[model samples]
Target: MWCLLPTPLCLISVFLLLQAPVAEVFLYVVYKQNSTCMDFRALSACFGPPVPREGLRGYLTEAAPANACQPIGSPPASSNSSEVFIALIRRSGCPFGVKVLHAQQAGYKAAIVHNVNAEQLVSMVADDKEIRQQIAIQSVFMGKSASKHLKRASRYEKGQFWSHLLKYSAYIVIPYVIQEFGFMINVVVCTITLVVCARWYKKGQKITVCTFKRGDKYDTCVICMAEYEDGDQLKILPCSHAWNTHTQILV
Candidate 1:
């Protein structure tokens, strides 16, 4: 096939796509009950070496209650589901690896852990190589706000799954779109500041050195707030701010 686009342009496009902001991840839970769909956005993605890498998207299930006090590495009965399962569980009462591996052994497609101590989201990490390798499912963490809603939805209300269907989909960006927006704002502010500084420099405003004279009523340097005695040398900034030579070092 003959190439239509320029080689450099194609390369740049591929590079840009590959260089997605690493810190940001996408997580969405769609819980459907009869006719209502409750959507939740996960706080952050899990730690290193997410299994399969393509990411997880399918029906979600409660591997256990948000506060299940179970033995470490023990797989619970809730993990037995015929559907592609995304397990939602608390981040305590066991090693994160234990809960995840147990869920994986019982056929969970992914795991969403909720933080118990704090409201902010965190990336779940396993220290053991052996345990990390056993994980063959994607995983992530959610904050308190979303987890509260999720725990309620994971139950059977009045003998039926409160939510008739549970869906879990992972993403790399856009769900954490605020990070990108914040980065952009920082860049724009920096750019605008640089432009303004350059324009000010171009205008050639000169800084003047003011020598203190005897009987001068303005005896205090505004920047350092030091009393200016006779013969004190001051640098008057273009913006009308002034400081004494002794205070210039601090500036």
Candidate 2:
């Protein structure tokens, strides 16, 4: 659990966590003359798709037929002019895996597939194959409107919009993140302490003593050489005498 009384650092961390606010997410494109953000529907078929990354992952500088990514020998080409090279692919002519894999090898961070019908938007659902499994980039789909906008926008600089996910999404923590960290630290400390105590006890480090028993040899205490009477407290010794002088433990 978290510390009963949170330390100054922990309290400050929690306060900072709460103070940060969530930012809205959107797909955007920036050109020399203009820049705009738009909402797009998407279905990510790649493994680990939920990892928050930049919204601009899959964008290509050139507009080409979707078949360009079909060849294994030749992956899709990215323009050297663009810093963030994402592949803009069409959603037809080959398996989605082919497009994703080819673009992946081409060094694009992500790939966007434009719908075949220009008037329609489609979900990206592909089979789990070796090629598909190999891909580890962002892939999204663009509707008729978004696809055209993307093509037009590609003429300019690529998008730079990203999720503030790593920023404020941490604030969604239950209770708070810093508290959780403190709780884990406390749990580890307590566990280690318990283990150490158990080991010490198992090694017989604990001092143990009880009242004199009936089978004890002498009834008198050797401390004052006094005879033990009824209900009288006395100490037994390993030597040939009865007294408060008991076992001499070597420490």
Candidate 3:
């Protein structure tokens, strides 16, 4: 004779089986003090700390330290600050204040805001009323190309460049290509079906032919004040107005 195990005992055994490995691994790492697992000190050393810089005329007053770097949001020397600001407006969502605060929290000393269309450099004043110790603000005008290069360089240092590439390739680029190929195949099948349907419809349709005399006066189109010619197709808009191709005007 065989004995039946209780339901609760089976559940507890499964749960323990699943959780035991993870707990054992965690405790083993903890006891061994292994550097491979989630070490804040090691990760911080890899990225390094932010370099501190004084805000001077909307630019960094000094260079970054050997291990750290700062983001300089300014136009190139040859271009004016206004142009940089305009460019910033186009590429970056807003004037950069909101992102500046986030960057400050991440240890950025100053944000060099630039114009995309002008040459004069301007400084962004942080709202001192709400300023926190982590917040630092600065601005400058750098050309669009220079600004892009600076951003890329910064990402490269933080190991974000490759990570971003991997994310895009996995989620965006590959999926987009697959979707485009699928759409092309679907379009080809639809075209063939449409051709077959059109041929069948023509065989059963009763075609009508009409002739119009030249110089037959018709109502002039109000939009362009042009007389409709023969063989011209007319469309009656939803507003109860009729117009021909030559006389139709888009608002």
Candidate 4:
């Protein structure tokens, strides 16, 4: 069990190794208006039909009710579902599958749900198996940053600040660090533990004491001038000296 002691760095590494990563495919959506276009990154749903590798090209549309939790009436003026359209919905009020189903009923080809806050990416899951089976179109979760860019692109203006690469660097880098340097980290931790045990062992060395024999060559304690008896205890030193002192040197 001595070898089981983990250093601070090892604890951190193990914690990272045990983390559950949200599984999703990363893809970018290109929003175009007139002659200008800008690309925004999004995370694909873990459930539902996958977005095609060639990508889904559609007109971006905001749902009539915004949440898309209920039956939607029609596509807004900015969108035309006749030529494939993708619905933009907010993150609350109902299950993600319900929102996507409402968008599907309104003739949208796909749906993109944006979080209320600029936060970590989350995997989208349907509320039940029936909802999962009914979803035929692809849906994705959009971060607030990307949603903000989409709003800007709607007005045909490019965003000035895009720092999603920095915002999400920790999630990408931690897993990579654990995968690449995990063995070396274990070796370093074991080495430190061994070195600590060595120092403790050296400091905790025990001096052995035994019963004195009456007829030994030296039969007296040099410090206290006490005679040795067969049953008397003697303290043995490293220099081959034995003493039978009743107080200090005797055990």
Instruction: State the RMSD for candidate 3.
Output: 24.4
In the range 33-136, model 4's lDDT, one tens digit per residue, is 44244555567776788776545655455676878888885554432224455778888899998988888888777888888776566778886888888888
Per-residue error (Å), model 3, residue 12 = 57
TM-score of each: 0.54, 0.42, 0.22, 0.52
Best candidate, lDDT-wise?
4
lDDT (0 to 1) per candidate = 0.56, 0.48, 0.31, 0.63
Residues 1-251, model 3: lDDT tens digits: 11121110000000000112222100000000111111000000001122112101121111122111234343224233321111122224433344454444433333334334543334333343353333443323334444443333332322211110011124324554687699999999999999999997875353332322355443556577776667765555445455564554567
Q: Judged by TM-score relative to the true structure, which candidate is superior, 2 or 4?
A: 4
* Candidate 1 worst ten-residue window by lDDT: 8-17
| Candidate 4 lDDT score at position 101 | 85
lDDT of 1 by residue, 1-251 (tens): 11122111100000001124565554454454445565555543344344332334444456554433353232333332543556677877767777777766666566778787677766677777787777776676767777666656544343233233232333534444667699899999999999999998865558778888877755788877988888889777777766787875642
Candidate 3: Cα lDDT at 78: 23
Q: Give the C-alpha miss distance for residue 25 in model 3, angstroms.
A: 55
Greater lDDT among 3 and 4 belongs to 4
The superposed Cα distance between candidate 3 and the true structure at residue 98, in angstroms, equals: 3.0
On TM-score, the leading prediction is: 1
Residue 11, candidate 3: alpha-carbon lDDT? 6
Clashing pairs in model 4? none
lDDT of the structure predicted as candidate 3: 0.31
Query: Each prediction's Cα RMSD?
Result: 14.3, 16.5, 24.4, 14.5
lDDT of 4 at 51: 73
> Quick one: RMSD of model 2?
16.5
Model 1 segments beyond 4 Å from truth? Answer: 1-19, 47-60, 64-82, 158-182, 195-251
Ranking by lDDT: 4, 1, 2, 3
